[model samples]
Target chain A: MMTIKEIRKRLDGGDISCRELTEAFLDAAKRDNPALNAYIRITEEEALRAADAADARRAKGEALSPLDGVPFILKDNINTKGITTTCASKMLANYVPIFDAFIWEKLRDSGAIMLGKGNMDEFAMGSTGETSYFGATSNPHNLDHVAGGSSSGPAAAVAGGLAVFGIGSDTGGSVRIPASFCGLVGLKPTYGAISRRGVIAYGSSLDQIGPIAVCAEDAALVFDAMCEKDPGDMTSVGSEPVTPKLTGSVAGKKIGMAREFFEVMSPPVREAIERAVKLFEKMGATIVPLEFPMLRYTLSTYYIIACAEAASNLGRFDGLRYGYRAESAADLDDFICRTRTEGFGKEVRRRILLGTYVLSAGYYDAYYNKAQLLRRAIKNEFSEMFKKCDLLLGPTVATTALQKGSGLTPVEMYQTDICTSSVNLAGLPAMSVPCGFDEKGLPIGLQLVGPHFGESEILSAALAFERETAGEFLKSSGMGVKL
Target chain B: MISLDELKKLANLAKLSLEGEDVDALAADITSILEFANTVSEAVVDLPKDEAAGAYNLREDVVAPSYPAEEILLNAAEKLDTYFVARKIGGTGA
Candidate 1:
């Protein structure tokens, strides 16, 4: 698989036409998608058309952005104009958006070719890709193992060389988890750093669209292109360009490690993270040991708040608007009831019910309100920790990719999100960079978390690690386009 | 544990109808999830005085041209010229 820089160099040198490059990717998708199930829909026509436009622009010597002519996949949750934006659910299976999502508009304006919509967990509700109505995305590394959710397809597609990079939304570990499992780089930018105008909301406060790429540098380029304030999404604060600041130097930097983050981690994951800490130390980074007791409460607080917001955000899926409508019903109320009951998957329904319970009159104070208060406590802890450390380092997940049909219960699945959810709760920037592999040869992700709007700092650190390691841990699945 | 009757009421509030075995399974799931969420109650922290105050800057209310009705209603299951076609109140047809 070629990096964006390699593709750009070839395009500039006239070694390859943009159309040919896009075709290569499209061909790869055709060959590999049957086994990987990476894409829910492949926009072959759109991709070729965009490739021609890119070639024409190059022919005319028009100014080009780094991502111009770059083919990438968008997670199914982000809307693309006139394209179906199913959140990997039956509810919106046939629903096409009339307008583009803000991030999609940004990418399209940059001349990024849309290959297709990547599969994901239904309504971005599950940690594993198995919950997707389209079906689970298989791990590119080992086909028997599952690709981590809910941005499973995006990560798989990128790892399988289906696209240069993929755009994914991370409410919890959706982006980073899969990237970790697939040996790729995934960034969940600070909340509100990117616009969410046309992103189908899961947890409005927690959800932020991010990049899944081969390396931190590629992730930085995509982030720079798509991060911008938009009137449509009032929460968007945009972001400063991080690519320019990626010095690949970690000298004199203080990296903090909280002891609590390791309690749930398996032995191999712990050793991998510890080795990464030693490598950073050798690169002149100071390791600061810290205790973050608040980690215990992040999972519960995150699930409560996320599900509560999800229940409210997903209320618009009634039969009257768009999406799947029941074939038969006795009355208006029955129509909506039947549609939702039939449309949503099991995991989505469970979350909606849980959210309904928390926000119900009597339980509001006990669950929703308590979670909010704990959210503040968690945020305050992050703020205090940032004062003493340049960045916090931890495991992206407690374990590697589980085999398909692991059949973990719902609560057990939610527990896997413990390492990644706190970043969203505090609206902090964080990323997963591949550090090493477990004994079973699955990738392990080392998480670099930064203060609010700290994308540059964390990205710089990631680039440094990538450079120092010479991408030794960034293994390829050897399945898709090898150009 | 959440009672089956309570789960039914919650499902009703969510506008979702659970039938037979699904009701039992969902009840167990929700109960376990709620139990997991109950861990938050044990957290001791200093509550902010302004808990309800949000920091977002509100955009000024401005009237703008809306999307074309046809385009907006493109994905609707059933639509008239400019409005969605839904079953009438107490109507029999789906």
Candidate 2:
């Protein structure tokens, strides 16, 4: 959880060379990857070369930025020029992006060593990383457990110490779930805060690229670099600069614990939230009770709308354009059918079918259109609640990391996102900070949700909570992460 | 409320071939998902009145040159010059 400032100090004092730092990460990745399975691709040769260039630039008295020389990883869904940008799907297994994602271009100018791609759910479809084509990323804390995903590999990479910090996409708790289970800091900034261009689309309205790191402040650093209005993305919002300041105290701030959100969680998750409330109270923050009955439909509305949009967005992957094309086909129809049939995985195909079903000619009004109305209701409920409190508190997930292939039905798996999905449906900013470990030594995460575009408040609260409850603890079982 | 037959139909529509194992798995997942679907239906019992759904003010539409056709087609397992070659259908090409 070394801050960017501390790492920069080490680099400036010659205590560590960029090459050594990059190599240290690469060497560690070689060791941990077998256990964690965090990376889809580890570009050691390119990363080392980039690190060498960074060192040369520094030696010439030209520093790229404060983030210069830092080594990091990106979720596979974010396009990287010349590197395969497969969204953990066979459909684009060999598809290489010709242009860099906007965030990639931004970070490149900062001279951060690109440690390569992390695995994710195919097309950012699933909450658990289990749906990936490559394989499920193991939780760094427990190899037998899942690294919560679709941002699975990025979360595992950062938490497992494969890299300092990694970028991930969150379209309904993808980033937060993994961050929670892996014991790292994960943030999903407001919907339009970051540009979505060049990043593979999931749910156009909900999909956003965020950061996962060992600590919230470092996430803030990466967050600052990611936020900007890009003309490429129609949804990008250019407004008030996101200047995250951790200097303020949480004393006298009002934190709301919604009764409705807490009703559906398990005992262990409840205990974690209780602990967070007590800690915030000790920090002199007022704990308030807030009610939002409309939140009950968050998951339902999310699935309907997300599927509808995904069905539309993913249609562009037809064999005629870019993506995997079927080797043998009888006609255009046969070709598209066979290619998509062969290319997409079960879970992805499931979503696409559900989406198409909901958006189809006859059913649109009954499903897709209804979901939109529910979405607006969910949004209104939060807006009213935010009027009474500065932040909303809850557990990131209902339970700790489940054992990989634990035989839970998909519905049971979907329920794990009960607490986190609502925030996404509301288009609010939220952070998952490691609270403590459960009885079995699994990490539990406390979620802090802020009003729209309230990333500064979210980060400040997370930083304060981490500073007080437990100094940053990396879930890396042994060698790397220490409290 | 969904049935195994419904799941099969959906999978076929999605162009996915499913085995008995997949159907068994998806049946349970889809059922539980519908429970949540019921919740959303109740919340929006009445859709919002006609007001333009907030549309994002898109930047001016400009068709810029993208990936070259050659590079884009390079990864295709089966392709002809400037076009992807597919299996002939209806015995027309034959």
Candidate 3:
């Protein structure tokens, strides 16, 4: 149950060797992963070797990054050399990357031990972990409920204490939503803050790799490690670090809570938001009511844009090219039909069709173009609102995690993403901090979004709130049970 | 009006193949999705023509390190020493 920082201290102090800690995490992962379904692969053999090297370095009195010797899991979508970065799709299930993702190299250079690959929705399309080809990731808090996805396995792994923290790509709350449901701190940094090189792209414009961890403080640490100018990804900001420059106080921060968001949330979720707002007010922050009427259409716009991008990005997965191909075929079309039929899951197929339809000739202006127009409107609405407030606040999801097989239709399932997608569309930084639990004992996350490149302020406010509340999700009883 | 054949065509463009029933299902699904999409015209006003009208521009052509031909071809399912081999679904006279 040791926090990441505490584990680091023990490693630095020689009270416990790095090898011992890695072994401990590996053991925990072996035991927990079965119940949680958090991992798609575990690198126990490699982790042990890395831990031994780290210990040797520390014994020589060499200085290392704070993350040294810490075991962390990565979402399967991010490439790791020699490891299969399947992106939870059967087509690429055995596709081991020959080169490491840029961030992977950075973390490796920092002396972090690789735990394994966490599961994710196929191509990061679904909001619920249910879309993963590997099988759904169960919420650690409630086994009968889903871990919010496509970062489901990452969040569940972190919450289950199978790994210190996990890296997940957030496109439309893929990271934050799971973090909220699993009661972890999920930070979707401002666009381009982290490099996307070697990470499988879902939506080239919207996908961002972020951290899901036990607390906001730990997320900041991970962010600092991965925050660098990666020449590999042109979109990466050049050698700029903003967290260290964050000096503002949340005490006097003017926070805006969207009335529109409140109208959509469940009663318990609304109450939790109210309670969190009051707590922030007590912590010297002021809450203001704001209107963002265009958010009602965020899901529509997000689906069109994200699916369109996905359709294009995933086109490279033809069987004869680089993915799993049928053993025998009558012809090339037969090969494609059989391979795709067996390779892709239901949700991936659904989205691919949806995306193709939107981007098809003649229909593009009606669907994709219209969605972009609405995206601009949503962005403009938030831009104007940001003029009056330092940050915007709302429940991360409209309701608590739904029960498994609750039979939510396509639209109902899409609605779960409503509260989180607007920030992604606006290209702003946001974090989901644990607020409270529902009567069913599931976690609720209160998301704080700031203007573009405002992660430092967002983190500062979230960290301050977490400190004031002194409530850690893992501290609650029944938290680590099957979800 | 969209039809199942058109849905199948869209799927083929996306490199996906659907059964006739799936095509029908997807066509129905897309029809509803497009119906909701039709509402966007009413939802947004004063759409910026310039913003919606532009696409990302690439930088000037420049030489940069690239994967060796062998390495690039290594990821292909079928590869020759100098090229990747795939069944020619459609390419010019193929």
Candidate 4:
């Protein structure tokens, strides 16, 4: 599980070949994916060929970028040209896009080898990996427990050493929750920091492609490779020229703590994040306790807005052009009806129906419009809070990884994302770095939230935290994280 | 509580179908979620007059090489020559 930086150094020093590294990771994926269900498809032929091409380029002293020869996994939701991008749903079970996502094109230019597409919650809609049509991704640390979703397999693959890092989408807590459960570093960069052109839309306004790696420094390396604007995505704001000063010193840095996030938090989880906050304080940082009244309603605001957008964005999948088509229908209406009803899973259908109800006449203002205004107020509150502090700290999730069959209702599962979703609502950057292990030996994560486009600042602070802790709890808890 | 009839209407709007007790179950689910979402109506806020941040980042109306028409039609279940084949919207040829 060498860092991408370490691997690059080795590649430069002639200690390893890109083809050899790709083969090794391919071997790991073969060994682990069957047990963990991490990868939906492993592109062995293309990846090894690309690896050889990379090696040849390096032999000619023409390395493309610093990330050249690095191997990583992509969440299945991202289009990879010829490879199938299923989004782990039956509807898209056969989808193979003709083009690559903006980030995929960027990573390709960097000469980063793709191992495979990681399994995820269907349509990136659920909290646990069980929602995947391919099957649930198991936590590498505990076989019986579930990996968090919708970026479940990406997190598990990184934590299981199947790839050097994983690229995943975080719409809501999809990326962070899995990273928290798997004890990996996952970043949800500021909205529009990375272009989202070829990503299969879930909640378009909230979705952003990001990196999940072993640590914040590794995540930072991948983040740099992905921060480019594309003409394809008009919303993508070109990454600001803010050189991340990784001072590793947080002296006098103001870290805000919103108590409402901890109100319903389990004791072990609360203790774990508070422990991280204390470590920051010990490093000469100042803790600024605060309250966000608007945040209490964010979970509701998220579902309303996210669902409304999903209902509209998903209308494109009616079996006319591509994706799953019903066997036979009397008319186009019946065709659309059968295609959607048969192709979608229970959760997807439920969301579509709820979204339809909210956006319907007479209910639009009461639900969708109100949610939008409340989202603005929440964003404004976060902006005002940033004026008082450099970063905000809290638990990544309210609890540790639940067992695979927790049987929680949809709202109950939605509650698990309460601490993480508000960041998405405000379009701010946030990272979930493993802080400590809960009593059950499950890992807990500390979520560090930053202002809009403050990726470098948050990464710098996260690096400081990772350096200070250095997985001290792993030794105490007897849980071996693949790193 | 949302009735099953309303659930059917929502499903119709979404272009999906819900039948039998599933509709009843969905009604309960949507109702409970709406109960939670409805609280946002109570939130106080002054709406902004001008919501747009600034000018749109409009790209030039340039015609680049698109996805080859053949490639685009490759996945269609039914196609008539270069066009995708579908049933007529309002008629079933009945």
Candidate 5:
């Protein structure tokens, strides 16, 4: 699979037409999607049409953005005008958006071709892709193992060379986890850095649409394009362009190694993270050992807040507006109840119930309010730590991709997001870059977390690591379009 | 552990029916999740002053051209004359 730069060079040199490139990706998706299940819907017609437009623009010598003519995958949750945005759930399985999402509009303007909607966990609720109503996305590295969720399909599609890069949303570890599992680069930008308008909300405060790519520079390119303020989403503050500042320099940088994150990692993950730290040290980065006791409370806080928001956000899915409607209901109330009960998957129902439990009158103070307070404490800890270090270095996840049908309980599954959730809670920028592989040969991701709106710093560090490793740990699955 | 009755009530509050499903297993799952969430109660820290209170990015109050009713209602399961169609209040089977 070629990087965006290489693809751009070829397109510029007239080595390949945009239509041909798009066809290559579409053909790859056709060939590999049966085994990978990465895409919920392939927009073949739209892709070719867009490719022709790109070719016409190039022919007319119109200015082209870096992503112009780039074929990519959009996560199913992000709305595309007249295209189905299912959130990988039965509830919205047939629901097509009348308007485009904010990020999609940006990408569309940049002449990015949409290959399809990537599969994800149903309503972006689960850590593993298994909860998706479409089907679990298989790990490209090893087909038996699961692709991490809820951005499983996007990561898998990118790793399998189905698309140049994929746009995915990260609530907890959705983007980064799968990228880590698939040996790709995933970035969850600082909260509110990108507009969430038309993004089906899960954990509204925690969710940020990010890029899943093969390298840090590619992630930076996509992030730069999408990070912008929008009137539709008031929380969106936009961001500085990190792509220009990716100097790939770690000299004199202070990288904090939080002991708490290290203590929870599996042996292989720990060794990989330790090796990454050593490499950064060799690159002239100062390692700052730190104690972040607040790490233990993050998972509970994240789930409580995320689920509470999810419950509220999903209330709009009543039978009247759109999506699945239950048949043979006695009344309005019954209609809604039956529709939701039948439409939502088991995991989504569980989260909704949990959220309702926490926000209920009597339990509000005990659960929701307590979680909010803990959220503040966690955010404050991250804020303080940022003062001591340029970035926080740790494992993206505690373990590698688990085999399909691992059948871990719900709570156990939620525990896997421990390493990635805190970044969302604190509304910080973070990226998961492939560092090494486990004994099973699954990829291990080293996380670089930065202060609020500190995308440039973290991305710079990630690029430096990517440059040093020179794609050593970033092995290909040898499945998709190889340009 | 959450009782079956409590689980049913919570499910009702969430607008979901617990019919024909494994209520016992769901109850166990929710109970364990609640137990996991209970760990937050042990966190000892002064509640940091809420810095984000009233930090909303309020756009100028202007009437913008909204999506046409036909377009907005394009995805509606049932619609009539630009309005979403729903079951009448307190009405029985259609």
Candidate 6:
């Protein structure tokens, strides 16, 4: 129950050994993982070895960084050399990468321990984690409810006290929604802010690896370790250099609450975010008002554009290489067709079909190009709104944690991502922090979104809010984990 | 609404096979999805190209040692030594 700051302080002060800290998390994971199903593979041996190395470094006064001994979870989609990166899909059920993801390499160099890869929706496809081949991750708040995904297990693992922090790729609400559901802090950095070199692609344009932690400060620390310009990634951009100068004060800052974000949220979610707005005002943050009609275009724009990109990105999985292959095939064509047909789940196939249709010659102008234009408009809409305010505030998800077997149809399911997807569409920095819990005792997350490359402003606002409210929430709810 | 033939065609293009109940389900799903996608048409306009396309990085063209051939092929489904055994095209190399 220690924050990364306290843990590092203790480790530095020789009060706790890295091996001892890792073993404590390992024991807790072992006790809780059976029912929660938080991790796909518990790399105990590797984690212990890394912890011992960290201990040795500390012993020699040669620790690599402040996060040297921290244990963190990765969404299964990110590659780890010699570790199977299944992406929680049958398609890549046995696929192990020969190289580490850029983020993983960065963290590894920092001496952070890898707890294991956390389960996700297949190919990061679903709003709920139920689409995972390994199985749905249970929300830490309630056993029968879902850990909102596609970063379900990562969120669950962090919330369930299984890891110090987690790394998840947010395409359309993957990291943020789960963080909301689990009552954690999840940051989806500006697109290209974090390198995507070895992440299994879902939407090449929208996918960015971000941090999920118990609070904003920890998220910022983990993000600092991982955010770097990778020559390997063409889209990777240089660091914005925010950490050293994080003035966690939002006094006199203009915090905008979009009318569109409030219009459709459930009552409890609205109340929590409204309460958060009042708190921001109390903290001397100015409240600005704005309405956006273009916000309505996001769900469709994100689906079309993401699917289109996914269609092309996933074309490499044609059964000739690593991953699940059909046993029965008469020819090369049949082999590919059957391999994909059998390997992919229903939702993944549905997306592939939709993506193909959008990019098809006949429908290209109508679907793909139109979505791009709408994407531009949405970006422009935000650009204009930022002129009136410093950051945007809203609900991360329309509702709290969904029931595990809600059996909501796909269209119904898509609505779960309504509040968060537009941020991904515009490639902006957004954070979801625990605001309060609802009537069912499930957590409610308050979202703070900043303008492009404005992570500092948003994180500062979020940090101020957390510092004000953390003690009360921690005392009452005990951090949203059932155990 | 997408027809069964259209679904099949899309599946073929995606290198996937649709059989049993998937065809009907996908058709219905695509229909609803297309209905949602239709919303974009209203906002579509021929706008000029963006003035600031953001800073893009161009790496120098340099030859670097890559993952070894054996290591790279470690996950290939059908492989013989370092060579991947792929489907024969053009009948014995013409």
Off by over 4 Å in 6: A475-483, B44-46, B49-55, B88-94
Pick out the ten consecutive residues of candidate 3 chain A with the lowest summed lDDT. Answer: A474-483
Which RMSD values do the candidates have, in order?
1.1, 2.5, 2.9, 2.2, 1.2, 2.4
Q: What share of the true interface contacts does each candidate keep?
A: 0.86, 0.42, 0.44, 0.73, 0.83, 0.62
TM-score of each predicted structure versus truth: 0.98, 0.93, 0.94, 0.96, 0.98, 0.96
Best-matching candidate per DockQ:
1
DockQ of each: 0.77, 0.43, 0.41, 0.64, 0.75, 0.51
lDDT values for all models: 0.91, 0.81, 0.82, 0.85, 0.91, 0.86
lDDT of 4 by residue, A357-397 (tens): 88999999888888888888888899889999999998899
Please give, for residues A55-164, the per-residue lDDT of candidate 3 as tens digits: 99998977478788988989999988777789999989888777889889888888988889999888887777888888889888888898898899989888877788
Q: What is the DockQ of candidate 2?
A: 0.43
**How much lDDT does candidate 2 score?**
0.81
Q: Write the per-residue lDDT of candidate 6 for residues B2-91, one digit (tens) a residue.
A: 887887788899989875555676788889978887788877555664434356678888998998999989899889878877654323
- Order of candidates by TM-score, top first? 1, 5, 6, 4, 3, 2
Q: Give the Cα error of residue B47 in candidate 1, in Å.
A: 1.7
Question: For model 1, what fraction of the real interface contacts is kept?
Answer: 0.86
Error of 3 at A89 (Å): 0.5
- DockQ class, candidate 4: medium
Alpha-carbon runs more than 4 Å astray in model 3: A242-249, A472-483, B20-24, B52-60, B88-94
Candidate 1 has a TM-score of 0.98
Predicted structure 5: lDDT: 0.91
Candidate 4 global TM-score: 0.96
Candidate 3, pairs of clashing residues: A142-A483, A143-A482, A143-A483, A144-A483
What iRMS does model 5 reach? 1.5
Docking quality category of candidate 1 according to DockQ thresholds: medium
Question: Residue by residue across A28-112, what tens digits does model 6's lDDT show?
Answer: 7888887788798899999999999999999999999868998889999999999999999898989989999999999999999
